[model samples]
Target chain A: MNLALVTSRDTDQAVRVASPLAVRGMTVSYGQTPAIFSVDMTVRAGAMTAVVGPNGAGKSTLLKAALGVIAPLAGSVTVFGQPMAAMRDRIAYVPQRTSVDWDFPVRVIDVVMMGMYRKLGLLGRVRGQHKALAQDCLDRVGMADFAHRQIGQLSGGQQQRVFLARALAQEADIYVLDEPFAGVDAATEKAIIAVLQGLRDAGKTVLAVHHDLATVPDYFDDVVLLNTQVVAAGPVAEAFTEANLQAAYGGRLTTARVDPESVAG
Target chain B: MGAEFVALSLPPILIGVLVAVACALPGNFLLLRGQALIGDAISHVVLPGIVVAFLLTGLVATGPMLLGAAGAAVIAVVAIEAVRRLGKIEAGAAMGVIFTAMFAGGVLLLEQSDTSSVHLDVEHALYGNLESLIWLDATGWGSLLDPVALAGLPVELPRMALALLVIAVFVGLFWRPLALSTFDEGFARGLGIRTAPLGLALVIMSAIAAVAAFDAVGSIIVIAMFICPPAAARMMTNRLGHQVAWSVVFAVLAAVSGYVLAGYGPLWIGAQASVSAAGMIATVSGIILGLAAVAGPHRTRNG
Candidate 1:
């Protein structure tokens, strides 16, 4: 291999060591009950990491707290070795599809343009280049034709694609998605995984709260098995084991099993 | 028109239109956010605000009244949030409880106070004296060009105009952020949009509109203008920009048509006296909303 290739490979290893997202002793509570308590996780750079757990396992809560979408009761989150506030521009977040009002009066393009709000700043007009960029992002998710349509007119899968297109428009270094595959069609899942893989291939980090355990081995390179606390976290082959899943999901996961080939990797 | 028209009809029509447009502007976002009753709540509480202001100052000054009403609006919002959080009540229930209690307290204060000389009665608070605010110095349409005649305009007219301008500027300056946050608060927050403060700012602007409109148009017209025009406009368009434009048109249409009908509809029926202009304005807006609900192109959600 060339010297440039070898140097880049060494840098990739270094980047993997230094994580894109690191949660240190995070504890969150809703009212009197704690949602996530004293949980810690480190997301590897240039790889897609799946956060899989049972329902009510605080998967969404942990992601929200880590991204500062909701304030944590205690502890801190660092993005790319810096505080979230300082490194906000480097992160792109896609919330749950149901988190927004579907009937809101905005076109698909308008929703996608919102991703560029930080760069546009207050009072900045949407020029032609911005529109072109947004359209290009939509094209990536097979949603370019729906750009002129009202957001509510789309099907659930199309809506998910539009949301992913919006995140793509953000052009951030780290992509964080919350249940991106939930409620979406199989086609949308395939399209989304392809986009995420493209992001990883481009040396960007991705962290997703995944619900389908069956797809974890095929989709994610790293895994964080969580149940209000970190049960196991590392490379998928090492951490996403049947024992770790059993410990994390307890008796809730009855049918999920680790693929032997995936573990052998 | 003649001097009679200039002296009798101009100021109230202008003020009425201004109040309607002001309230309807913020009403669009409020209706979309499912907080339509916030307008209703703010209008009701303004009675207490003005009453306390009049009680304190012993003079029916515009400054004290506006200040008092804004204060009451803030208190009502805070109280509603407190009740929803601490008392574990839903927002609608909390709003209903606080606004009605404050309104009842205001009526009690009005009855107990010895200010029978001023125009601060409960009926005036509800219906407003839109017909009574006439311009005496205007001689004709020539008054439009005469600075001296224009200077003698009703204070409420200029105040309402200024309030409408402020509200319009606010909505304009924050249109993108407001649309993003109102549509998806979590996504907006992730983008570092400071959605909480933006929501509070929106409420404050709504309160300002409520207080300004309440001073001239009464709580009836304030509540009607806040919900009816925007809700009607919503049925007419799927685009927010179009909805806002349609709302302004509907507000103006309601104000002008309602004023004319209230003034002339009685004469057409051979009645000597005019009806309450504020009530007529509200009725006209409700009628517009009813029509839009029935026949507007985008009335249904699927459209």
Candidate 2:
């Protein structure tokens, strides 16, 4: 019976290897207030997952801690079945649009080139090819024409797209974004979704902290309904139900409704 | 333009320029990071560092002073972080609480200690002795080729030059990472750049510039140069590279023109004695910043 239990555990580990990002027993706090509690989550490989929660629900905190931007009080994160440190280059992250100061004196191209820093290493010269690659990423995000323009000159949606372009320039296997669609125009929203869908088609893993619940079913294949902890995490059809939404948001979110059958089909 | 220029005016102007460049270079990043007051804080704290160093060594030497100032800068940073974290105070408030206390303590120490034999005093610390750093060994332009004459140059000149070189090299070697981290710390950290250490390194570089420049040009120029030239340069360009380049140009301009105007401006006005070159340098930098704010093309956010 013990041998059977060990074999089942080995099988579970094998299954975890196919997961792009996995977090176990993660907890984080700010000052005296706890932001997130012990939470366990695993995102499927080559799939789009949306992390949805109400305001102050630790959605952004979870992403930040998992990415090591802020130290976690407790937990471990793995990327591609390896420690996040070892697999850092294989993951790209797009911080929230408001996280950085737009008034910073840098052109659109310069911001995009930042994505290539991991590959460039310290003291590595940015070659012409690197510029072209950054430009290509900008083109992918429909921001190619704004290459010479300063970042502050662009609108909010354009800024978000530029950030996405920078993440694209990383060309990593996994893409993590925080609030990618928050304050963007409808056109930019459509364009960004199309690009993200293209990334999915190319078999890249994507996990984003999505606030808009109306588009969750259409935008993602998987959903992690979270408040302070993981309420439910699985395919959008199974995990993004009315019960899960109620459990995660309590009375804060009254309008978000997801049809399990529609999402499933 | 012969002996008078080489002996009296040249060394101060050069030192002034080096100080401006050193402070303004790091000032660019600090200003953009919205931590321009870090420079201001550092200059204010430098007095206490120098006084403490003097108290420790009982000698007014450059090496001991630099170490003491560097040590003080580090302590100030640590204290600020601690207050901000432990007391849950805002960063600006914490900085204000610590720097002002340290600076006041330094002034009190200077007053209480016996330093009548040395050239150390509040006036010298505030305005500096820029006018007195004259090259008496140089007779004329021919002194340029004379090694013995060069050896007689004020020690502050070579020291400031070396400080400027070190700052420039630091800015150059770490330009990419610094800019990236400054622009977006989270993204930079995500790329495994180690943002915290990079930030501390930047503060250390700023402290070095502050300490080195504080000795010759005084705290006034140290504070002004750290904010003005870079703030003006920021108004001139939308690109970081261009902004850095423009800051150097502005630093040089402020140094040379401020020195010249201090000496000759008073003479032209038919006055007997020249005004303080350090004060004039700081004033010139402020004026340049004002000009950029008013007329610079990229001054506004829209641009």
Candidate 3:
């Protein structure tokens, strides 16, 4: 680890408790309506954590607040015990594919290159080396051949892969994803899980807002069940029980069941 | 045609090309962001800005006009934001109301003032006084190099050219940030790109383009050039780089061809007098846009 790049305070905090993400008494509201309130969660460093919740469960909101995308009505979040701003270069964010205008006239390579925009902004030109790095990222996600295709021409799984490739291009210490597995095929889901597991092996943290519950224990080492608050958060086997799932999903047992009516994980 | 006739026609034609290119360059970003009417809104809104500046300074200098125009651009955006919030109106309606009200107020102010003595008037605000700009005091190209002749150049042409250069530099320098911000604002923000300053720069660039084109192309053509060339270019290509290139090509084509046709089309029909060049340029850009909208590769007819 490059101690020179990180603040001393952050290093001390990481040594005390190695956690990439920490949300203490966090609250977020939208126009007088509280979306997520009084939530506290700390994701273990170098682990894959799945944030599982029903729709509007503030699962995505939690990630947004952690990244400073949405202002928290209360509480604070830190990355490796430092403010997100100070450690921004170490965080890679992958927003939901639906949030992007897929119909925008751009090639897949252009979207991947956006991850490198921060490094090349206005001053450095996009050289062949940058393109090679972007291509390598794309190849990792198994979409290298589709680099020249227009964004609007991709399937749901392909679009998701492109976004992951973008985050890969960031070369960050941690990745935060929103709804990555939504509507993707089983093969894409496996591929994504493999890539995330590889990152975990490399001592990098990945926090994803996941909807599929059946594979939580199989795909993740940690779990945070949330519904306007942290219903439960710990090791996946410990926190992902049926009772905690019920608490997060309210009385709706049908959708709360593990992966409800899908192929077995 | 005689060399004398060619020299007489040179300045206006060049002016049209410069103004069209200047307006169209920034227009590509506006088109991509789905803010095509912002140019029109700026052109109309800046009328009051120019009028108030002229009213206060009692002179038609670029300095006061530019200051007033920039101020109005800021006010116009602020007013639009207020209307959208207060009236609970959508952005389109809010923009429409503010620009039209300010334009009407400008016309009223012009009518009430002693602008009759000045070259500026309400009628000229719509169609422009481009036909009257003649820079051929000397005979040929050699005399054009003379310092007196150089200094005596029409201010409108030079102003439009400088605006073009500024637009080129701005887009070139900020291409990455601007493209990222426009395409995905949230993603840009997450990348720690401060999008607000870039957005403000975009609005300021539009204001500058509007102010520069106002004296030469008028409010109507300023708007037409802004929306039409970019929209046509968008239809012609799916890549942003190609869109910008095709937009410049379309703009130059429209400018030169429109000027030539406006000044010479009637002579082909046995009529003696020419039509308004500004109107022709606007019309030609519209026709190009209409053609692209109907026939361009980007059209969506079927799967």
Q: List interface RMSDs for the candidates, in order.
A: 1.2, 0.9, 2.5
- What tens digits encode model 1's per-residue C-alpha lDDT throughout B57-102? 9999889998998899999999988898798877789989999999
Give residue A156's lDDT in candidate 3 (0 to 100): 92
Write down the C-alpha DockQ for each prediction: 0.59, 0.82, 0.46
> Where does candidate 3 chain B have its weakest 10-residue lDDT segment?
B1-10
Screening candidate 2 with a backbone cut-off below 3 angstroms (N, C-alpha, C), the clashing residue pairs are: none
Chain B alone, model 2: TM-score?
0.96
Candidate 1 lDDT:
0.89
* Residue runs of model 1 more than 4 Å from their true location after superposition: A1-17, A255-265, B87-89
lDDT by residue (A173-245, candidate 1, tens digit) is 9999999999999999999999999999999999999988878989999999889888999988899887888
Model 1: colliding residue pairs? none
Candidate 3 clashes between residue pairs 3 or more apart in a chain or in different chains: none
Instruction: Using TM-score, give the best candidate's number.
Output: 2
The clash count of every prediction, one per candidate, is 0, 0, 0
lDDT order of candidates, best first?
Answer: 2, 1, 3
lDDT of 1 at B207: 93
Query: Which candidate leads in lDDT?
Result: 2
- Chain A TM-scores, all candidates? 0.90, 0.94, 0.90
| Native contacts kept (model 3) | 0.50
